[model samples]
Target chain A: MSAFKEFSKGIYAENPVFKQALGLCPTLAVSNSVENGLGMGLAATFVLVCSNVIISLIRKSVPPKIRIPIYIVVIATFVTMIDLSMAGFFPALHKSLGIFVPLIVVNCIILGRAEAYAGKNNAGLSFLDGLGMGIGFTLALMLLGVIRELLGNGSLFGLPMLGAHFEPVLIMILPPGAFLTIGFVLGFFNWLENRRQNN
Target chain B: MKDILKLSSILMLITTIAATALAAVYSVTKPRIELKKQEALNAAKSVALPGADLNAIYDVKGNDKVLYYSGYMDTTKSNLVGYAFLTSGRGYSSDIESIVGVDSTGNIIGIQVLSQTETPGLGTRIEEIRYGESLTWVQKQFIGKSAKNLAVDKDGGEIQSITGATISSRAVTNSIVAGYEDLLKQLKETN
Candidate 1:
């Protein structure tokens, strides 16, 4: 694939959340607010890009049999760095993100990219893949967040948008709301794809 | 056997590098993290005991489970604002942590739910304030009420549990009551 395509694939064709369905845990959990989704997206992206570059660099020496563990350790280290730095500098955001921040260590997206793409690709391509995937993931989460927040809280990013008269759909902010919103979004995307093919 | 040796050695090297990186990051971030935590706690204290003299605040040895801090208005100690303590209890899911402030008379000045993993929209309502002329705030319910008065209304106490979060509400109330009793015992001993 061309360099631009390598970087752009994750934005649509190989989208992490929507197309690949990776990292749904953080995608759903943190998508309650735009700020939260953005934070998680950027954090995951940082971990993804760093781990990808490192994993690609060392892939030549790493025996395939032990590659998984090494990738995990590398990904975990970056996750801890992000977690600690977030706690230190962005205490409030860190507190709000809570366990999800640390939980990123187990997010399959980072490790999946490391194993599937970075292990075989060159460093530059691996880096682009991570950047694209991370941005796609962040955008997906933000979309979910915007919809849920607007309907559930009648606000966007905690700012009142719908005004006082608008009674928020209380369910939209709850767990079930996440499932409902994601289900409809996936369905809409599928329908659009099908229509395009039919045309 | 030769291949296994190579694999194990490579893995070890990777692990060592990761460990070193993490240790370095921890060293750089540790002090800053501690400072942030202290700042957050200080902010929570001021909110829980608004107007309490931050300079006069002192720590008291409590059962190791909970740390206690008391703040006074003046050096003479005539105006004792309240005692602030950290308390946690098993809620519907995760442990609900709260900072509770109580005056010398054992009346709660205020309580703030510092952190919780309760179910959103339901159990999370413990942190919500209902809108109306009467003004019903869940955590604020305990404010000005004594430990003896701290039970769910369903249990014949003043507190009205959140409709779908009775367990969480009860957990917070019980934790506060327990902390209050402990504080009272300590105050008596000090006196």
Candidate 2:
């Protein structure tokens, strides 16, 4: 029945990257750069919102037996659109995101939302749910990107922030760095969530 | 029985419609995708080896552990600039690929990373920063250095290894050494 709270839950309670852990592949891959993470997050948001709204409108007609395959077909269609548009315009981000763009078809966040919320909720709520989750996903990705870029490259968005005194941690830019940073951030988020619950 | 048959037919109809729509989208985007790939290749070549006036390029087959690209450069003024070689060597986490511009006398002119999948902070020094905060080291080490002493100074060579990424540093040096030798051999037999 509530609207604003539905949106807010996505940021903290149901954070796709850290809490729900949906779409882990791109969250890990594109988090290498703030630009990459932000780009991927926005593109994913487009797909999630569009698919959720449409699915919610047609939920009753889509028979339960064939709903899973139908949801995939819908998601894959939107992903292909993002792929073509990115390749045409933003070739650099397209290259960075690479195969992960197409792989969005299988991202649990979109499919899970479609099956759960979109299938039951009204179209308005479904749209809000998608938007909220998307912004949450984007925020988490940017947070990771900023940390990784600052520590690894000793820069934020390719501009030197710390100057000569900073010793860039070599491992922060590697694959291991992604894992370690995400793990630490996840732990921190969990700690914050627990503390919030206690309060 | 008639009702069940009608329901099955309806399912088939939905599947067909969805398939048709998906196929239409693919057909529309396929050519654009191909053109984008070609443009990206040209851009990468231009940045890696400046002003090559690149002709056709090829990925050399059956080589040992290196991704190689050797191609001819067609000059504008009725002259040739010899072959350009893009070869790979070992780096911190993966093999480092370098694009080399060479003249007829086998002297190295300029080199840059065509692409690298190295460790972000540590091994990325191969693209070492020359002046600014850019990755300048990797490209600069090739300056004035010959294919003769491509190995790092530790291995009785001239080039210095990156401070923390010695293995990655040496990996790149070894790749360059071997890559030059291989490319040189190819250039000689063909020319």
Question: In terms of lDDT, which candidate is strongest?
Answer: 1
Error of 2 at A32 (Å): 3.2
Per-residue C-alpha lDDT of model 2 across residues A51-74, encoded as one tens digit per residue: 999889988887787778777877
After superposition, candidate 1 runs with Cα above 4 Å error: A96-98, B62-67, B120-122, B128-139, B160-164
lDDT of 1 by residue, B1-191 (tens): 99889888888887898889889999999999999888878888876776688777777765653357888886567788888888888998779888888887887886788887676545666776544323335446787788655788777877888766788988988888887787777777766
Model 1: lDDT of residue A89: 96
The Cα error of candidate 2 at residue B18, in Å, is 5.1
Global local distance difference test of model 1: 0.83
Name model 2 segments beyond 4 Å from true.
A1-5, A197-199, B1-32, B43-77, B89-97, B128-135, B164-171
Query: Which of the numbered candidates is closest to the native, going by highest TM-score?
Result: 1
Report the lDDT tens digits of candidate 1 across residue range A142-165: 999999878877767666687768
DockQ of each: 0.52, 0.30
Which CAPRI tier for candidate 1?
A: medium
